[model samples]
Target: MKLDVNALGTFYRMAREGAGLAAGRLTHMTEVETQVGVTKLNFMRGREIRRDFEDATEKVAVRVKLTGAIEGYSMVVFERENALRVVETLLADSDSETDIDVDAGEFDEMTQSAVTEVGHIMNSGFIDGWADVLETVIDVSTPEFVEGVTAEPFFGEVDETPDEDDLALLFQSSIETVGTEIGFSHYLFPKRESMAALLDRLRTSGGIEYDKLDGFDRMAERGAEEVAKTATTLTGIDTSVEIRRLNFVSLEAIPEQVADETLVGVAFEFDGMPSGYLLFLFDEESAHEIVDAMVPMEVDEDGFGEMGTSAIKELGNIMASGFLDGWANVLDTTIDHSTPEFIHDMGAAAVDPVIIQLGENQEFAFVFDTVVMADGREFDCEVYAIPDENDLERALNNLDVDRIEETPTTAEFQELENS
Candidate 1:
């Protein structure tokens, strides 16, 4: 079936509102603000899922099966660090941290109970809102707390169909609670037939219009220019950031673009309008060239070493700040970036952590691709940004809302995939 744009927009709005309710419930339970970021509806094919999760770090997943009407699944997925923070917040009065072993795949009973409650509230908030909006009934199974590294069959595998024709609605939300920001991708992995039914319901329901993404694309282009300017300044060479693409795409589809290639990845979290993640990608040659420029090394190096990585990290910090500064100036909001983390690995492994964390709450990520040129020599690079709904909306609001256009064509996504 061809994707229905109107139905998809309606679904996005419903999911966003539903996730907001879930965040509210969480805030009540933890006495901390549980802000819900924007939500995304991902159309995922089953065959490519393993590759999607292969190197993704494991997290604690609380899954609740759906039995009535919409037959599928709903769950809240959390990274280990956030999971630990949640457990600690839940047992603030008591010293559960001292008694429980904080293994990656294992949690103590008390921690399990707390995380389960979180799952329960999150799942209910999402499904209940969906049910009310669709005017349907959905019975939730008992919330199950399972801890693992990947969403494989052993963890929280919701997709039973493996064929490319089968589509799953992976609705995700960026959740902030207990002084931590984690993602909660609540998946509705209905069978093909069931998905058709849900889409039918959406078609009949009044659709909610979402803001267009073109403005952000333009903003990203400007940010890329700023980054290039920074590189030129630091290196005292003619440097430029050539924007290859600026688009939002499914998290799974992202790695497919740069997969198998060895890359230099630098990432950092930022605190701003809605909080976001910024990543810088570079090929080995590009990384070395940039590092050499940043540090002005005497000996030409073909391989990236510890010192080179540190120099690149510093450059990443500088470039990221320059890019974010443009956003801050345009949006008239303060954007603060954290320290950068550097990694040299295969494309999949390098991006897995950031992609997994951001993907947990939303299936789509805003990828800004750029190729750097230093002294007329081209270098491949990318800067991917995943901002929550709140920030996206705020950023869009700062622009001409009247210019919000229809959703970009599938051809645009295809370009990212094929790029």
Candidate 2:
């Protein structure tokens, strides 16, 4: 199937709209003020789902098979405490005389039933949103309850369906509550062919300008994700993208986000169809942490001295290469970046050169505002990926989103042999 950025954008809208609906339902049910929070996609393969659960915190999820508009499974996952808290709400709303303990550390039959209802509400909201957009009906099967520390409950049912490199779209949503606090995420695991067909349908229904902006948003998301992955690999620390944001503002407003104190950073300029400058800034403490993790020596340098600078510069090189390589893969082209320009000055100084160069012809720029942080506040790095607006459009115009697919393994071969 041939897919483009437009389809991906449309699917993003579906995820956003679905999250709003789910939030509204929760607000209505519990009578608490609830709102939708960050929504983004993660593309991962079948056999590897380590990104879904970084550590083995106990998780409780309700899974239900989906058919009609889309096929596969729709799951609502909650932390163990979060699930118990949800049961608290349902029991409060019920006037029955049945005895139930919310904090029992284990689920009873009645408690299980109550949590399943909550999961069903969440699943229905997302399905309704997709049905409205696609103008079709989606039928959901019986709810299945599973509780464990691993992702096996979710994937055990589908070992043969997804190939090794098949891309699965995982959407994580945070519903902000006012008085009571309950945090959970919704996951959709669809068959590859069904997902491809769904994207093709969305592609047939959107426009050009919107597609370009959506394409840029996706580019920023993936670039930030790569930075986190690279940081983890180099530092032996587990890091993830904390906050991902993309905004369009004037050149002057870009510097307003920088700090007043001195910062350690790396800057680079790239040349390609959608070429621009990339700047990564780390706070003094974060820079020190990276040096400690990567260098593993006690360097008594007051400022970013020679040895400290070299360590940071090397990290910057790998980060820049990964960020541009991600963009190149999406656009199916090559983007060459210049030598890393080390920055050991004030925060705003790192962005001034790019601002002066681009401010000449353009009034606004798309700034990828991302925060990549590690556990225990050990690593907190900020990414600023600013690409040329005109060049980005031209490159996206020639982009095919489905070009990123990898060949499937032997799932189909097994099916044929059985037949």
Model number with the top TM-score: 2
Candidate 1 residues 201-282, lDDT tens each?
A: 6563232122234455455565777787787787666865555444445566566666488888888888887478788888
Candidate 2 wrong stretches, greater than 4 Å: 50-55, 89-102, 157-163, 179-182, 204-269, 273-277, 287-334, 338-379, 383-419
- Please give each candidate's TM-score: 0.50, 0.62
User: Residue 191 lDDT in model 2?
Assistant: 73
Clash counts per candidate, in order, are: 5, 0
Worst 10 residues of 1 by lDDT: 409-418
Please provide, for model 2 over 117-140, each residue's C-alpha lDDT reduced to its tens digit, 9 standing for 90 to 100: 778777888878877767888898
